[model samples]
Target chain A: MAQLTMVQALNKAIADEMERDSSVFCLGEDISDKDGGFGGAFAVTRGLYEKFGEERVLNTPISEILISGAAIGAAMVGSRPIADLQYGDFIFCMMDQLCNQAAKMCYMSGGQVKVPMVLRAPVGATQRGAQHAQSLEGFFTRVPGLKVICPATPYDAVGLLKTAIRDDNPVIVFEHKKLYGGKRVEAGAIAPVGEVPDKEYTIDFGKAEIKREGTDITIVANLLMMYRAMEAASHLEKEGISCEVIDPRTLVPFDFDTVIKSVKKTGRLMIVHEDTYSNGWGAEISAYVAEHAIYYLDAPIVRVTTYDTPIPFSPVLEDYVIPSTERIIESVRQLMDS
Target chain B: MEAKMLLEMYEQMDLIRTYEETLYYLFLEGIMPGSIHQSHGQEACAVGMLYGLRKTDYMASTHRPAGHDIAKGVSVKDMMCEMFGKEDGCCKGRGGAMHTGDITVGAIPANAIVGGNIPISTGIGLSLKMQKRDDVVVCFFGDGASNEGAFHEGLNGAAIWKLPVIFVCENNLYGASTSIKNTLNIEDIALRADSYGMPGEVVDGNDVLAVYAAAQRAITRARKGEGPTLLELKTYRIAGHSRSDGCAYRDDVEEAEWFARDPIELLKNKILKEKIADEQILADIHEKNEQIVNEAVDYAIEAKEPSVDDVLLNVYWEGD
Candidate 1:
């Protein structure tokens, strides 16, 4: 095992998948180049163009609809395509393709066709303003046919990406901009440099990883917020408030068992996400835990998420809006005090 | 057009017209489940563009997909079953009228949203190229769909990659009730194809031979790795856009002018003028196709509905 950044792990996963499957290919804007293409907006696909060549590492125009819809069509045929969107906010441009075409093709075709394509987009408020910043997991998780995965660490990124590429359905991998540590670094990035194995490995969906073991409270988070939750747990430990941090890697195929077990142990649940609070992924978790594990919980479910407003361009407001370590700690303290 | 091809297209056109007429009557009787996007007065464009295509080749259609699906060789009985929401339907009763298709015959499920299938065609072409196959994909849309974001993006992508895809815009002179004259500045939708650096041709959609010849050139260019070509079939929608539309927006004079140039009527006249087939042979073919549709209707009415146990099946692909 070696320490690799999330971007490096993702690049390795794509290269490995391309090498393993001849039908596997990638298409996006500025993703292809023999001499180190833009490697995508976050440099995740760096050097894939030279290794896989133009046929596999195709460079498309700045058309999100075409990128996504073309990937759906290619996946409908024989090829397994990995389509990349420069930013997650651009996903709205291909909403028809993703929510309608890709999501309904298999069902609409009576299970005759399989759209085995992967759409990778860098999500989260990275100070790029409203047009570029948005956590799209909530939008996609509500979609029945599409699988949504958000890997925070390098190990999960490589493993889940491989699984997503190999899965026989449309999978959307929402990579957090702050977690992607490479040549380009974000202003307030917390690079989760975990050890990724050298040998091929795949992490299955619906399995939540417990980041920190504790017995006071359970914090369920994913993507960048997962790191924030861990930091909150570290801070809360000093004040005699132990918190168990759980990263439910995939929002669609959620590992509720792990979350339930953690909630049962702690007797408290606090769900956090970078998405807006209104109808956020955290709300779903809160509801599920309330319905199933309510008897075990000693306190009401607390949710820490972004406000129901657009991500601000100003760093101060953005930081204030997004759930920070202090906010998570304060929420934990309130739950403890209550 | 050759006699064999001409007669085949005529028979298919007749079948589509009869099928559409039958559906119109059925919908009027309140027997149909969903709203209909009938493709009347545009049979020549669908038949002429799809009749020459191989069953292995792919085609994506708009909401009005019965003509294209039938032309692309989707089973009549399955399409009927789908319309009836029967278990034996092409999509196992999952897809209703608007989303009709049989992937086994290379007709992707029809896109109800306008211009939704254009970029999908580009991807299908990309897949064909990646798989090292010569098969081409044809994307059928309306003049209004040409203005959608998917159209520009899909066409531009196909052009740059030289993907084997034909973007067929059935300029039926209307985007629903809105007139093309008011919506678009250009008279011909083919002119927009120039923006993508591909050759665009405008064809007389009322004349099957003209549409057939134009489609042949586009298909040939695509097969030769020359890139995509846009074919604008200048046609008109004789029927309302949907079931609720009364077509009050269309003037009687305009309707008569287009009705006089009906594609089926035009094709029949051409066949008779060229002495391709006698009146008896044409009548016999029409009678046969009508009988087929009649049989499909009967089968669909008698087909079984999906069981309660299977209400959960075929949502996500459980591969073999």
Candidate 2:
């Protein structure tokens, strides 16, 4: 085992997958090493171009539609491609390619083709204003054929991404910019470095990882919010309120079993996410828990989410808009009081 | 081209015509389930461009894809079953008229979105290049697709990488109801290729041999590791854009002029004039192709409906 950051782990995962499978390649803007280029927007792919050469690590023009469509097409014809987008907000530009082409190719072709591809996008409110900063997991989770995964730590990043690369379906990996603990540091970034195994290991989808074990209440979160939830759990422990924290590694093939089990044990549930409240992924989890484990609940389910507004540039307003550890504690206290 | 190749092209064109004409009547009688964007007058474009392509070479098609699908070697029975929405359909009844294809024959499922297949075809070309294979991809779209952002981005990517993709534009003068005259400011759609630094050509879409010749040059260039080519086939659709669309938006004089240049008739005349085959041989080929379509229709009508239990299947590929 070796201690590594999330971005370094992701780079190693791609390099290892490409090394194992010749058909695997990387394509996106500024991913190549020609002319001393940086390895993508977050530097997760920094050394791949030099290691794999230009054919395997291609640098595309600023064309999201072409990048996505090409990935789908190449995947359909026996190539496993890992496509990258600088920001998750740019997915809107290639919605037709992702939603119509990649997502539906297998079903539309009557099980005749498989689009084994992965799309990586950095999503978080990093004070880049509305166009650049948005947590887009909610949008893609609603899409039927696409699988959505958000990895918070270095270990999950490598395992989930490697599994996504090998899976015979189109997967969207939403990596939070604040959680990408590499050289490029952000204003409010939390660098979560963890030990990743040197040997090959893959994490199956639909399995939730419990960050902390407790009994009073269960907190479900992912990406940046996962770390925040852990912090909330630790803070709540001081006040005699034990909290259980759960990070759902994959959103689409969600491990509802783990959440249900945690909720059963705690008899209370509170969801936390950086995405906006209205129709966010938290809503789905709330509804599912209500439908399946309502009788186990001692209090009504609560959600701590970003306000229903675009991410602002001001640090104070941004922090206020997104969920905070204080908000989780307060929500837990309210649920405990009720 | 050899006489055998010329005859094969005519046979495929005849088959597409018969298949489409048969579907037209069936749809009119309310027998078929879904709507069709028929390719009635654009037979030569599909047959000519796809005649000699190997089964490993990919072809991406747009909404009006029957001719292109059939010409690219999707079986008559599979397409007919697809039209009937049966379990034996090309897409197992999930994808209807606009989305019929067989990937085993190198036809990616036809995209119904206007210019959706352009960038996808470029990706297939990239895969072929990366695999060190000499196979090429032919992408088919209408003049309406030329206005899409996908067209510009797809063409530019293919040019920069020198991917072996042939972007074929069948300028049928309409994007559904609106005429291309109102949509495009330029006279030639092929001229847009200049922006991407690729060779572009215009051909008589009604002439099968002309389209074949242009396709040969483009395909050969692509096979030699030269960049993509944009071939604009100036044609017109004799049928409406879809079911129940009357030609009120089209001028009678323009329609008459294109109708007279019927691709099948042009091929028939050429075959007889050059003595490639006698009139009796041409008649036999048409008869045989029509009979094949008739048998396919009968087979589709008797094919089984897809099981509801399998409706949730194929949504995701579980394993090998």
Q: All models, DockQ values?
A: 0.81, 0.84
Cα lDDT, model 2, residue B76: 91
DockQ category of candidate 1: high
lDDT of 2 by residue, A1-338 (tens): 99999999899899999999999999999887678887888998998987899999999999999999999989988899999999999999999999998999889888989899999999999988988899989998988789999999999999999999999999999999998887789988998889999999999999999999999999999999999889988988999999999999999899999999999999999999988899999999999999999999999999999999999989899989989888988888999999
Top candidate when judged by DockQ against the true structure: 2
Clashing pairs in 1: none
lDDT tens readout by residue for model 1, A12-110: 999999999999999888887556568788888889877888889888888999999889999999889999998889889889999998998888877
lDDT of 2: 0.93
Clash count per candidate: 0, 0
Model 2 bad stretches (over 4 Å) = none
Residue B194 in model 2: lDDT:
97
Query: Candidate 1 at residue A52, lDDT?
Result: 80
Candidate 1 stretches greater than 4 Å from native: none
lDDT of each: 0.90, 0.93
TM value for model 2: 0.99
Model 1, span B122-192: residue lDDT tens: 99999998888889998999999998988999999999999999999999888989999899998788998
DockQ of 1: 0.81
